[model samples]
Target: MSHAPHSPLPVGHYAYDEVDRTFLKQRVAQFRDQVERRISGALTEEEFKPLRLMNGLYLQLHAYMLRVAIPYGILNSGQMRALAQIAQRYDRDYGHFTTRQNIQFNWIRLEDTPDILALLAHADMHAIQTSGNCIRNVTADQFAGAAADEVLDPRVHAEILRQWSTLHPEFTFLPRKFKIAISGSPQDRVAARFHDIGLMARNGENGRPVFEVYVGGGLGRTPIVGVKLRDDLPEEDLIAYLEAILRVYNEFGRRDNIYKARIKILVQALGVDEFRDRVNAEFVAMDRARYRLDEGIVAAIRARFGVPDFDPAGQAAEKLAQQRKADRAFDFWVRTNTHAHKQPGYVSVTISCKPAGGIPGDVTSSQMNLLADLADQLSFGELRITHLQNVVLGHVRQDKLYGLWQTLEQNGLGTANVGFITDIVACPGLDYCALANARSIPIAQKLSERFASPDLQREIGPMRLNISGCINACGHHHAGHIGILGVDKRGEEAFQITLGGAADQDTVSIGQIIGAAMSEDETVDAIARIIDTYLARRTAGEQFIETCRRLGTAPFKDAAYATA
Candidate 1:
C-alpha cells in the first residue's frame, strides 16, 4: 500500500496521519495471522517467540505482557482514555507505567492482543518497536517545550529519530536492544547519559540548533557512561550522523556473548577516539544528500507540534499565592508537585503516581478517567508520562492550581512528592517480570512506609532511589543517587546497594557498589542506616548525594554493617 497524505494535526498535539494508521492496521493483521498459526500447531513456541516479540508481546511468568509505546511520553485525553479502556477490558483494571515512558499490561492474553492493538491504532498509538533487539521508544525530557529552561523542544528531533528508526532495514536486528534519548534542557531529566545514544540540543555560535552527541552508554549488566562523539553537530546532519554511528555499531558490536552484545562493550573495546574515527569515516563516505533533512520537511514536522494559546490577560500569581496562604496542604502540593513553565501564568503539575505504600507506577481505571478529564479541562487536553514513572499536566493555568489540587487530592493522586526519596522509580520485579531475581515493589513500599512523613522527606531533600529486579536495569537503578538492584543469592532474594550515582546536570556517573548483598529485611534497615549516616554527616545544605560524594562510602558502609 502506498503512503497516505498527512492529516490535519490535533490542536496542541501531533496526530497520526493516514499512512501511520494504515501501517498499524497492516502490522496488526500480520501479527493476528502469526497468532493463528501458533495456536493451530503450525508453529512451535520457539519458532513463534521472535515473531510475537517484534510486535511488543512477551510471555512472562504468569501471562503475556503487552508494552505499548508512548512516544516521547506525550499523550492526549483521547489516547489516555483509550488506555483506560484497554486496562479495564483487556487486562487488569490498572496499567503499569514503566521507566521508559511506556505502559505495560501484565495480564494480557495472546488471543486478545490483536484486538487490543486495533484499539490502540484507532487512538493513533501502537506497541511496535517496544520489544525485540531494535531501537526502542525514543524518550525525551518530560517537560520538553513546557520547561522554562529548554533551548528548544527535544520532541521535534525525537520524533524525527522515531520516524527514521522505525523498522529501518539495516537496524531490524541489532546485536542487542538499542535505546536513544534526547534532552533540550540543561538538566538531564530523561537520563540521557544512560541510553545507547544521547543527544543534547543547544544553540550554536551561529544561532542554529546543534547537538552534542554521546554514544555507547548503557546500564544493563555493565553500566558505562556515554562519551561525547560530536560537540556541535548541525541540525541537518542528525540522520546522517546517527546512521554513521549505527553503521559502525552494527559492524563491530559483539554478537558472540549475550552479556557483551551492547554497543557500550564495543565502544569500550575500541576506545572512544577509535569509535569516533570509525563513525567519522563512515559519515564521510555515505551519501549525505540521501539522509540530509530538508528545511521544508523540518518545518512541516515542527508545524505539527501545535503550540497552546495562552491566555494573555490571565494573572494567576496573586490567586495562587492567596490559595497557598489559606491552605497548608495546597501550599505543600504547589511547592512539591509543580514545575515552572516557560509561559507566564501557567505551570506543569506532576500527578504523583507514587503514593506512599502503593505500587510505584500504577494508576487505576477510575484514576485514569479522572486524570483524563482533568487534563482536558485544566491542562489544554495534553498530558505527559514522566520517565520517573509519574504523570504530568504540562499546561495548567496557575489560577486553576488550587482547584486541580483539590480534585487530585480527592482521587488519591495528590501526593506531594515529586523529587523526594519516596518518589521512587521501580521495575515490576518478581511480582510481574519473569526475568526478575527478587521483588522490587515490596521493598519500595517498605521504604516509603518507613519514611512516610512529609516533614522527614522535605528535610531529606531531593533524592532519587531506583530499584531494578535484575541487572537488566529496567528500573534505571544505575542512574539513581541511591540505586538498589535485586539479586538472587543461593536461590534466595538479596538486594545490592550502590551509592553516588547521578543522571542529571551533565554529571553522569555510575554508582559504586557499597557492600555485599543483604536479605529483604536487612535491605530496608540498611537503607535507613544509610540515611542516618547521611543525616549525621550532612552539612546544613548538603543533599544525600552530595554527602555521599564528599565522604565516600566509608561511613555508610560502616553504619550499614555495624552490629547494634
Candidate 2:
C-alpha cells in the first residue's frame, strides 16, 4: 500500500516537507520487509532486534511495545485520531503517554507492526528516533508558544534539533541513549535540568532567542544536574555548540561500562571546567558555516507552525464566573487543571489522565477520539502532551472550559487532579518493562486510591511525586518532590523514598534519600504517615515542598519509619 498520507493533515502541527514524507514512506516499506523476514525465520531474532528497535519497536515483558515520537509532544487532531485508530485496530484499545512525551502501545503485534507504521504515515507521523542509543526525542515545553512567561518560543529550536538529530550519522551509536529537553519559558515546565542536554531559551540583547546551555544532566543510576556550559550562546550558534558537546562526549564518554556510559559520568570524571574547555575547543576547531543554523531557515520552519487566529474577545470569561459559582467541582478543576496563557481571554486546559484508580498516563481509544474532537472544536485543532504525562488543550476559550470540563467528566477524562498527589508519575515496571526489578503501577495506583479525595489533594497542594521500577529513573524519581525508587531486595520488591527534590527551573534539585527500602504496603503507609505529619506541622498556605524545606526531612523521616 502507498505509505503517503491518505488525507490532508490539520495545519496546526509543524509542517513537514515532501522530503520528510518520502523518508517516512521509505522507512515504512523497509520495516515492512524486515518484519516479514523476521516472521519467516529468514532473519534471526538477534539480527532483527536492532532493525526493530531502530523503528521504535521493543519486546517488553508481555508483548511488543511501539514507542511513537510525537516530536516535541505537539499533536494535531488528525495525528491524534490516527493514534486512536492505531490503538483500536492494531493493538489494545489503550495507549500510554510516557515522561519523554512519546506514546507507547504495550500490546502491539509483530505481524501488525508495518500496518501500524503505514497508518501513522497516513497522518504524516512516524516512529523514527523514538528509541536507540542515539539522540532521542527533543522534548520541549508543552506550553512553549502559549505560556505567559515564555521568553522565546522553543518550538522552532526543538524542531531544528529534531530535524538535525534524526539519523545523524556520527552520533547514531553513542556511548548510551541521550535525551535533550528545551524550554522557552523561564518556568522550565519541561524539566530541562534533568535531561542530557538542557537548553533554556532566553532573549539576546537584540531580543532574539539565545540559549543557556546545560550539559551532562540526567536521572538514571547516577542522577546529576547538568552544569551550565554556556550562559548566552547566540541562536545561530545553537546547532554548532550542540555538535561540539556531542563530539566531545562521543570521543571521551565511556563505553566500557553501561552504567557509566552517560555524558554525566564523563563530565563528572573530567570536572565541569575541563569538559567545558574541551567542548569549547571543539566548537572553535569545527568548520563554522557547516553547522550554522541560519535565520532564514529558522524563520521558514517557524512559519510552518502558523500563529493561531485567537478571537480578540474569545467570547470568554463573562460566563466563567457564573459557572464556577454554579458548580464547585468545576471551580476546583479549573484551579488545578487550567494554566495561564499568553493570549488574553484564553487558557491552556490540562486534562488529567490520572483518575482515582486508573494507571497514570494511560488513555483509551475512545478517550483519544473524544480528545481529538475536542482539540478540533475547542483547542484550535491542536493538542499537547505534557512532560508530567498529562494532555493539554493549549488554546481554549475561557467560555468553552465549562462545557469542555462537563464533557470530559462524562467520559471519565476529567480527573480534576493535574499536579496533585493523585496525579502520579510512574514507569510500567515489572508489569511491562523487562528491566524492572519491582512494580511501579500498582504502587502508584494504591497511592492514588489512598489520596483519591480531591479535597485532601487540594489541602496538600502542588506536589511532584514520581516512581521508578529500577535505577534507570525513567519515571524521574530523582527529581520528584517526593521520590520513590523500587529495587530488588533479597528476593522481593523493596521501595525507598526520597524527599525535598524539585524539577522546576526556579528550585531544581535531586531528592535526598529518607530511609531504607520497605515493602510496597510499607511504602504506601510511609507516604501516608509523611503526609499526615506535614498536615500537622505546616502553616497556612505552606505547600508540601515548602514544609519539607522549612523543617527539612527529619520529622517526615521519623514519621515514615515510626511504623517500622
Candidate 3:
C-alpha cells in the first residue's frame, strides 16, 4: 500500500505489531474495568481521579474535559473525523485545541470517557500524557517537515523524545509540569524559547544537524526565557544532554512549593552559568551506554517522518494566484492565510479556529468533519494543529484554494484574519481554572471586537495580543507583542499592560508593564488607546516593537497611565 503524505507513525519509530497491539488491547480492557468500578461506586472520586486523569479525564467547571493527545502534533483526516464524531456525539458539540497540541472536549460525562478513549485508540491515537505532572505531549512547529525555512524537521527529534519519555520510571513525578518544544527553523513560530526545554535545530560548521539547547524557561507568576546551555551539540548527543538536564532539575528543582517548583525557578535561583555547569557535570558523570543514540535507530525514526508524496509540478501556486483574480474573498485568504511551502505547487493554509466573539481555539463538530473532508480532498488527508491554537491543512494546491475557502466560509471556519488582532490567544481563566483571579476569554473577546478590522490589523503590522487570567501565563501573554496580564487589585479584576514583549528567535524579552491596572471594560478600551497611540507615534514602516523601542516606553507608558 502507498503511504499517505504525512504518516502519523514515522519510519524510525516502532510499528504496532502483534505484541504492541496486544499491549494496547490489554490497556483498553484495564481502563474499561476501572471505569465500571468507578461508576458502580466500587471506586471513589479520589480513587478514580488519578487513574482517570492518567487517561486524560478531568472534571472541569462545567463538565468532564476529555483531552486527547496528538503526539508531536501529527494527525490524519480520519483521526480528525473521529474527533469530530466524539465531539458531536458526546461532547458540547465542539472541542478546544490547546497550546499543548491536545484537543479537549469540555462537556464529557464521567461515564462516557472510557468509550471516548476506546474510540481514540481505534484511530491509532490516545489521551496518554494529556494530564498528570509527567511529560506532556511533546510539541514542535506545526509546519514541521513542510516549512520552507526549516533546516530539519524537528518532529524527528520530538518523536524520539516522545518514545523515551513515555512512562519512563525516572522523570514521571517531577517538581511540576514539564513542556518541551522544538523548532527546525530559525523563525521560531513554535515559541521554543518559552518552554521547559527549547531545542532549535541548526547546522554546525560541519553542516550536520546540531541542536542549540535552552533550559529553565516557563510562564505563570514568573515568566522567564530559557538560557542556552550548548550551542552546537551533535544530534547523537540529544539524549545525553536532555537526560543530564532532567536529572539536575528532578534532583534540585524546588519541591516544597508547588507554585515555585518548575525548573525555571531553580535555574533562575542558581543562575544560568551555574545551571549550565551543573548540567555539564551531570552529563560527564552519566552512564553513556543507556542513553547514547544509535545511528540505525535514528535512521529508522527519520524514515517514519519522511516527506509526503508530492508532485514536483511548479505552476500550482501561480495557477492558484490566477484563479484568485476571479474570486476576491478567496484571494484574500490566499494572501493572508496561505503560507509558502518548501514544495512548489503547494502552500500551507491555516484554518482559523477564531470566529467573531468565539473562543480562539474552539472548533465545532461539523467544522471538524468539513476540515477532515477538506484535508483529504485538497492536501492528501493530512492536517496539523498549530500552537497558536489553530489548524493547518498542509499541502493545499493553489488551484483548489477558492473552493476550500468557500467551504470554510460556509462552515464558519473561514476567517481571513489569520494574523489580525481578533485572532487572539487566551487561557481558560476563572471559568475553568482553579488558580485564575480574572476571566481571560472575555478579555480576548472584547479585545477582538475592539480592533476587529483587517485594515487596522494590517496597519498595526504583525502585532501579537495575548492575555492571561492570572500570573500563570498559560495564555503566553508575556511573549505577546502587546501583552496584557490580568491581576487582582484590591479584590477587583484589573489588567496590566506591557510593551516590547516577544517570543521569537531573535528576542524573547518579557513585556514590561507600563502602569497601574484597570477594570475589564477599561482594559479593552485601553488596548485600543495603546494601538491608537502606536499609530500616531510610529515612524514610517516601523513595527510595534520597533516603535516601542525607538520612541521609548515613556510615550506608550504615559499613554497607558494617562487613563490610570
Candidate 4:
C-alpha cells in the first residue's frame, strides 16, 4: 500500500440518497423544529442531549463542541465557506480541525446549535454520529481521489459505508464506540493501522477492487495495531465484512467496565486469529449479499464527488516561476507547504493550523472565511480538512502560491513547515476530553518549543511526535516515530515513551517502551535524551527509526534512566 491512506467505511454506512431540493428543504425544517423544542424546554436536556449529539452537538467544558462531519474527508468551497460563516456568527473566533477529518467549533452555545445545523444542512453537511458510541465521522486520505498512487478513490467506499451505518439499528448500542478507516494508497497517511477497522484497497487477479481487512486496532487504554483478518475480499463483500466485524464486537465486547469496553479488548482476549475465525463464521452465516452494495448507488455517490475543472490553458507554470522569483518567502512556502497534484496545472497546499507553541488544530473564524474565499477565487470552491488536523486547499494553481501565502500569512496560517517536527498531532488531553488521564497540549507545546527552529526540523527530516492524553491513543502516539502516551499514576500524571513507532506505508511498527513512565516535568527531558542519543549514533542520512533500530533502545533507555 503506497498511494495514500483510507478511511473507516463503517462510519459512512448511513448516507441517505440525495433527494430533490424539496426534500432537502423539508429535512432542515424538521431538524429546526426539533431544535426549537429542545431549546424552548419542550424537550428536556436529557431528551435533547442524544438528539443534539446525533446532530453533532456536544456540551463541553466551556461551551458546546459541535463536530461537523466532512464525509469521507471531502468538502467543496461552498461547504467550507458555510462552515466559516457558522464560526464567525455563532461561536468564538475559530474552529478546530480534528483527526477524523471533521471540523469542530469549541465555543458554540446550546441555543445556536440548530441554526448551525441548519447552515450545514444547506451545504449538504451535518454533524451526525460525530459523538456517542456509534460510528464516528468517516475519514479517508485528504488526497484520496487525486493522489497519483491511489488505486481507486477510497471515498467511494466510504460513502457506501456512510449509507449503511447511518442510524443502523443492530449495532448502534454496542458496548462502546466504533471507528473505521480505509485507504487506497500504499503510503498510510490516514493512519489505518491505528483505527478500529482499517481497509486497504487492492486489485485482484481480475483487476477488480478487493479489500484487505484489519480488525481490532485502537489507541485508547490498550494500544494494539490492527490484525489483518481477510485478504482480497471481493468488492461486493464490503458490507458483509462490516456486518461480521460489528456482530463479533456487539456480541462479546465488554460493557461492565467502560475502560475495557472497546472492541480492541475483545479482539485481544480472543486472540487475533480466533477473532478472525469468529468474524468469518458470522459472515458465512449471514444471508449472502443481503446487504449488497448496488452499483447504481455507488455510482450516484461517486457522482457527488466529481473532480473540479482545471484550466490547462491558463498561464500556470510561467506565473508560478515569476511569483517564486519575486518572493523568497513564497518560494520557501512552495517547497514546504505545497504538494504535487495528479492534475498537471494544480497543486495541493497544506495550511498549518499549528503555529509555534499554539494548539495543533485551531482555526479562527476569520481564517476559515478567508480560506473559503480563497478556495472560490483561486481553486475550485472546495477545501479539505486533513487527518493531521490541517486544512488543505486541494486545487490551488502553482501560479497562485504567492497570493495565497500572502493572504494566509495575514490570517496566521502561512507556516512554511508541513512535514517538520513542530507539526505534531496531539489530542485535547486533560484540558478537554474526559477520557484523558494526563495533559497533552502542554507537552505538545513544549515539544514545539524545543523543535521550533525550521533548520532543526528540516535537519530532523520528518520526525513525528504524537502525544496522547491517555492510552486511548486519540493522539495517535502509538504510531508516531516518537510516541508519548500519558498514564495515570494514582491521581497524578505520568508520561510513557515509545521509540521507533511509524505511521507510514513501508512499515507499521508500534514503538517499544524505552523506559518506565516519567513525571510531566521529566518527560520532555526524556524526549531530549532520546533525540540526543539518536543524533549521536546516526549514520549519514539515517532516519530516527533506522538509528533507533541500529543502536536499539538500550543506549537511549540508559541515558533517560541515568538522568532520572
Which candidate comes out best when scored by lDDT?
2
Cα RMSD, model 3: 2.7
TM-score of each: 0.97, 0.97, 0.94, 0.88
- By summed lDDT, the worst window of 10 consecutive residues in model 1 runs over 1-10
Greater-lDDT candidate between 2 and 4: 2
lDDT of 2 by residue, 236-325 (tens): 899999999999999999999999999999999999999999999999999989988788988888888877767775447878878999
Cα lDDT tens digits for candidate 3, 1-564: 122355555221224446555666677778889999998999999999989888888887777888888877778778889999899999878888888878888889877877887787777778877888788888888877788998888877888898889887898888888999998876787788788999899878998878889888887778888888888988888998898999999999888999889999999899999999999999999887788788887887777654566766567667776788877767777788888888877788998888777788888888888887787777777788988889997777666777778888888888888876777888787777667788888888877777766667678877778888888787888888788888889998888887878887396788888888889888777778788899998889888888887887788877766775
Candidates sorted on TM-score, descending = 1, 2, 3, 4
User: Distance (Å) between predicted and true CA of 383, model 4?
Assistant: 1.2
- Ordered from best to worst lDDT, the candidate numbers read 2, 1, 3, 4
Q: How high is the CA lDDT of each candidate model? A: 0.89, 0.89, 0.81, 0.78
Model 3: lDDT equals 0.81
RMSD of 2: 3.3
Candidate 2 vs 3: which has more TM-score: 2
Candidate 3 regions exceeding 4 Å error are 1-20, 326-328, 489-492, 561-564
The lowest-lDDT stretch of 10 consecutive residues in candidate 4 is: 1-10
Query: Which scores higher on lDDT, 3 or 4?
Result: 3
**Which pairs of residues clash in candidate 2, taking residues 3 or more apart in a chain or in different chains?**
none
Per-prediction CA RMSD (Å): 3.8, 3.3, 2.7, 5.0
